[model samples]
Target: MATRVNVTVDAHLAIEVMLLTGTRNPQDAVELIVRDYLERAQRTEARTGDADDGRRSSDLQPYQPPQG
Candidate 1:
């Protein structure tokens, strides 16, 4: 069985989420919002890749001007 978690949110915010999700139950609306957020984040991460995959600042050297 899944554990039940309780949270308190502003009534206006809850109503907004419920309206967006088309769910009458606050719990269902919140769940949908959370799931959608997680899915979007995962998709974004997949496209951009991890930050550690790029070059580190320590690998860079001070720029030098070219002499004519």
Candidate 2:
């Protein structure tokens, strides 16, 4: 399920996101951006181990987010 909400964003950032993501709809662009952000966070957590504890097993390396 999705919730409906209104948000205000900078005009330049909105247009840039639209062009970069090839999304004409503002909502779609925002969703894509948010999804990517969440994915990156999850990936980081998986690589780095528990963030609160700050304890990591020697087997795992630091998380490096993907670059375009």
TM-score of each: 0.75, 0.71
Q: What is the clash count for each candidate, in the order shown?
A: 0, 0
Model 1, runs deviating above 4 Å: 55-68
Residue-wise C-alpha lDDT for candidate 2, range 13-39, written one tens digit per residue: 999999988999877898899999999
lDDT by candidate, in order shown = 0.91, 0.86
Candidate 2 similarity to native, TM-score: 0.71
Error of 1 at 63 (Å): 8.9
Model 1 lDDT tens row, 1-68: 98988999899999999999999998899999999999999999888777687655557889999989
Candidate with the greatest lDDT versus the true structure: 1
Which residue pairs collide in model 1, if any?
none
